[model samples]
Target: MFDVIDFLQTVGQDAQWRHADTEALAVALTEAEIDPELRVAILAGDEQGLQALLGQDPFCCLINPAKPDEEQEECDGSCEEEEENDNDKDKENDKGRG
Candidate 1:
């Protein structure tokens, strides 16, 4: 089996490959010795099909950190509150043990 990840990386890095026509992409996929099913999925732009073939589930996660200068005070207040609550819980547990 051809390395699907490497094939994807090659296509991703090359604008020409990424924008190639279906016929041209089919030729390239043939040259790359890609799996027939994967070639079909790529040609059809089938994200779910590609994921199934690659044994991957559709997943996305994004994290945007707050600006330190602008959000620091807000974060500090909430974080300190959570810490104090946790500390209180710990103290309560310690009293129970004693």
Candidate 2:
């Protein structure tokens, strides 16, 4: 997990306007760190909460977007499982030869 204080400190060093308010943000991050559910909720929002917390626009795919692939889900590594089976067969052949 990214530490909010460290993130804020880095932002403070890079931007002048940020340096002034990062101290406050650091304190807010302490509370945010303790409450993971709140943090997840905040991260799930579209823009307003993200802009306030991260100082940038949030582009969440869940919000203000079209459903491009409602039916299609990403394939999990089933192909790799098949490849591993092939490897096991090769190992068995090697053992027979030895």
Candidate 3:
């Protein structure tokens, strides 16, 4: 996953925490080092530089939906924990009956 903080610092400049801007198309030219050419372009608001930078990465440009309904059903962890707790309770009840 991309580091949102780094990208925000790149554009927002000294943004304490929040950095994601859906409207602003941030093109990541390098993973670790921000290219001098790109840095100059961002500071100067150079249109051509922005255009050129877009060509550098394809997958990074697309804006993902705010709430991806398709993947909402997928549980990260909390839901699994709740399911496990319910199973444990059921197992205990079964042991008592047995």
Candidate 4:
């Protein structure tokens, strides 16, 4: 038998939770020493006092490419610019072919 709550309990583990996004309101719940079940309730986002506890500009993306350890300064945003140009050229090519 498997439990989803038990499996994702890394959010509750001290070590694992340390690596998680500290900007989330969940951090406050953890810091307050709230019970796991109560903490889960706080994640509802609609609860009172929840917004005040969360960071103003918290990490919003669950799959953000940017990380504290990695640096993308070398690319200088050129990769994305080139990709957009490539897409434009692709659309033009398709139109001509059609």
Best by TM-score: 1
Spell out the clash pairs found in candidate 4: none
Worst 10-residue stretch by lDDT in candidate 4? 1-10
lDDT tens string, model 2, 59-96?
A: 65755554776665577999889999999999999999
Q: Which tens-of-lDDT digit does each residue in 16-95 have in candidate 3?
A: 32453422343343544556566557547676765576464424456667575555455579988999999999999999
**Candidate 4, 25: how far from true, in Å?**
26
- CA lDDT scores, all candidates in order: 0.86, 0.57, 0.58, 0.58
Q: Residue-wise lDDT of candidate 1 within 1-98, one digit each (tens)?
A: 34877888888999887667889989988998899999999889999999899888888899988777764344547888999999999999999999
Best by lDDT: 1
- Provide C-alpha RMSD values for all models, in order: 11.2, 13.6, 15.2, 13.1
TM-score, per-candidate, Cα-based: 0.58, 0.24, 0.27, 0.27
The TM-score between candidate 4 and the true structure equals 0.27
Residue pairs with backbone overlap in model 3: none
| Pairs of colliding residues, candidate 1 | none
**If both were scored by TM-score, which would come out higher, candidate 1 or candidate 2?**
1
Q: Which stretches of model 1 miss by more than 4 angstroms?
A: 62-98
